[model samples]
Target: MTPYENVTFKERLHEEAAKLKEMSFRDKFWYIWEYYKFPIIGVVIAVFLVGSIGSAMYNNRFDTALSCAVLNSRYDSEALTVDQYFDEGFRAFIGLDENTKIDVDYSMSPSFDESAMNEYSYAELAKLTAMISSKGLDVMIGRPDVIDHYGEMDGFLNLEEALPADLYEQVKDYLYPVTNAETGQESFCGIRIGDTSFGEKTGLILEDPVLTIMSNSPHTDTAIQLIRYIFEQ
Candidate 1:
């Protein structure tokens, strides 16, 4: 007889469920939640776990995306932003201070004496290498030039023929030679990055000694993942 009777049974059931939900919010929310405590707890825990994992996955994705962006354009402002973000995210994983500085400097010789030249003019790439390695950057650099001297370096120099043998022997290595620890090894190949001018019009050329940091932060897992990404691309 009523309008409800005109509607189908399914519609009536849905309507009833909606009414129950509204009532539960007003009068029975606590009771209903407690009634299914186990299921509710399970859902709460599941949500938390999923959210944590999702955040980590998102950071990883962001790192990969930002790295690609950096490779194409180093000077892009976006690259700097993304790199900062990635560094912040990774910093969360690494136990380090908020103000930790990652100073990078390139030198013609890893053994360059700070006392001889402008100490501040150059960032100690060798020191950086030592820190990275000590921290177990987990990534190993194949070339001695790639890292700071882990031990003393001993080898032949072509310049010996041009200069006095005695002077050459004393000066071939820097006053503060970047030496190896276990095996005496010194850098062989290096690029002068400082004191250079790319443009003809530029009066003074100042190109700092160029240093190559082959990998990002020395996280082996991160490095492997990058290799995979590169191959796939």
Candidate 2:
């Protein structure tokens, strides 16, 4: 007599299916986990990594602070890195602490090709206006043309109103006055960021940098403090 006379492959398969059906929910879950745990964990990790990278990129682009924004007019072939100019004099001017440091945001003027008139494009202007209105921006550094463009819109803050009496007296010599279009009043618009020597210590100088400040900035006091430091240095 054969030992497997009563048993068949079909019978064994039926028995296994019956055992699976009888399993408790927890047991069934463990059975699946035993087979697929690695793939599940890998998918979860991938999702987390992607989420972290996306958040970092978004913040890097849009997360601006109350900062000194420099809009360069004439492109100089050779220029020192912005860091090169932030020496002891610049540091003291901005009230640098262990936790806080000066932030100078720099940008080139809109090229003629970018905006036929060498001005900000509509979209660019919109974004800039949003930043300015939000007080994310404080100071501006650019040239005459760049200054005139913003000046016409009455975008710049009035030093007379923004600065303390003593502070204004210290930096007024460098300020260029402009008339407000809406109010029809005159005020200092910006300071000339010239190639003029900031003396021997601050060796690196920007080629034709104009310094201006924004109106309605929450950090106007901080901006004035830096301006005072610059002039004093």
Candidate 3:
């Protein structure tokens, strides 16, 4: 029986508009907020989600030509310099277009020793595990202990199989043999780079640095090329 009960939607809208027009700007704002706050918030959230998804999709459109990680690095300055050098040099070495991306991550410093392990080390290990599982990591460069830890997990490709026969023969003396914990089979999983001119050329110091290729690398050819490039340099 109320007057508004019989009014059409258009009529009600006009009445509300007229009321808003008569009110001060402050009152109009509060009135609209009181009635439409939920809808306005929903619109804002929807816009943010749409924008995030679009950004992710656009970013993923570029193919990752190669991704390498340096673990347990001691000097941040040297690592950072080498990181930039590799990012620029590798792209040029491979003759990749700008659309293709190459990443050299030196941010991880995982400690495998029980006494040295902490929350941060565990977090880095988890991140490394996730990247390897997703095939996002192509190569790993680290100390002998770090390489051995992952090698025992059967995480690396056998250099004998991964490298060209001639290349393998050239570095055969420097091969790091690792025994798989599960299969008990021994394979040459890493190449000892510390003894090479790697430290001299790159200025990244490590006691016994080794390079290993991930078993599930999507870019094995690029990984091999990277190994060759490192030794060649």
Task: Assess each prediction's global lDDT (C-alpha) against the native.
Answer: 0.35, 0.61, 0.80
Which residue pairs in candidate 3 collide? none
Instruction: Give the lDDT of residue 61 in candidate 1.
Output: 44
Question: Across residues 81-186, which tens digit of lDDT does each residue of candidate 1 receive?
Answer: 3333234543344444665432211122333454763332233333334334434232222223333432233211222233345533543442222443446554
Candidate 3's TM-score reads 0.70
Angstrom error of the Cα, residue 106, model 1: value is 12
Scored against the true structure, residue 150 in model 1 reaches a CA lDDT of: 29
Model 1: what TM-score?
A: 0.24
lDDT of 2 at 56: 37
- Tens digits of per-residue lDDT, candidate 2, 1-233, equal 76446879898668667867999989878875686677765665555445535643555475333476665433333553455555345655565653444555455343324446311343344445555765667887766676767777798887767778887776667778777677777778787646344323343335556678887666676777767666665
lDDT of 1 at 145: 38
Question: Listing every candidate in turn, what is its Cα RMSD in Å to the true structure after a full C-alpha superposition?
Answer: 21.3, 17.2, 11.8
Quality of model 3 by C-alpha lDDT? 0.80
Query: Candidate 3 on 1-233: residue-level lDDT in tens?
Result: 99899999999999999999999999999999899877776665555455545743564688888888877666645444675456677678878787787877767888877897654555566667767887878999998888888889999999988789889878888899988999999999999987676666555666788999999999999999888877776
Candidate whose TM-score is highest: 3
Q: How far does residue 123 in candidate 3 sit from its true spot (Å)?
A: 1.2
* Top-lDDT candidate index: 3
TM-score of each: 0.24, 0.57, 0.70
Query: How many backbone overlaps does candidate 3 show?
Result: 0
